[model samples]
Target: MAEENGAAQPQVKMQVLAQFIRDLSFENNVALKGLTGTEMQPEVQVGVNLDAKARSQPNTFEVNAKFKVTSVNKVNGDTLFLCELDYGGIFLIEGVPQEQLHPFLLIECPRLMFPYIRRIISDVTHDGGFPPLNIDNVDFLALYRQEIARRQAAAQAVAN
Candidate 1:
């Protein structure tokens, strides 16, 4: 809360009301047999997606960060394990201008939620009898820019 020019303003409030694992799935496809104890190191494939949507309440939104990791024995191409996680947070944002809303929601909000989600991924894998997979830092600004360009291209194509 702030006061300026004899008026009260929303003070650019941003808060995370709650965060949780919306969905999670992990598969250890094969027993710990040939998956390990071999000369070849298993390759891990990771996929990531981020999404945000407005909630019914004003200034509230849902932000989702999704991750998928698959492990494969390189030599045999055999599946070792797979894990998919959808993590989300409920956020409250106020007093931001409309022009800044998209980036704020997509980039900033998810930026705040990523660490907790990453830890969940690591813990799930470690408990499943594999090494904890520490995720790398993400560039949210670049991601947001790409998404904006993609949406604009789609709109331009539709306009034509």
Candidate 2:
């Protein structure tokens, strides 16, 4: 008997729609404090949430990767708007193979979101009365590979 993919039948194509910021809010330096030490202990808290919207046609979807960042003092309760940004992208991906789509979603989609995310972070930090926060470029490709490897290792270990 043929393997039943059922509702999970793999689609040969995929695509992204216009990934724009649906909503965003930023709070700058809430509290100010004098520095005790020249070395600042910057603590960054990053939260990421994933969302997907299906298009009218099958295999087409828009993905949003939202990132929220809050920086605070390690010793004191001082707050800093290091960065907070919601970035999204609409990708036109179709007629592509399934194996290829994984990387596209994980890497390519995030890549598209990066610029907007960076901008929001920089502006928010600057407006908060601090130097702009320059976030480094992210390598989604490498990350995707690493994640895949880790998952495979875990599965192998479980089987053994």
Give me the candidate number with maximum TM-score: 1
- Model 1 has an lDDT value of 0.86
What is the C-alpha lDDT profile of model 1 across 99-143, one tens digit per residue? 888789889988898899789989998998888988787788988
Badly placed stretches (over 4 Å) of model 1 are 1-10, 32-39, 156-160
Whole-model Cα lDDT of every candidate shown, in order: 0.86, 0.67
Residue 124 shift from truth in candidate 1, angstroms: 0.2
Model 2 lDDT per residue over 1-160, tens place: 1246444534444344566776677765544444545355777777665554546766666777767777787767576553546666767777567666666777767877788778877777777777777667766677667777988999999999
Give the clash total for candidate 1. Answer: 0
| Candidate closest to the true structure, highest lDDT | 1
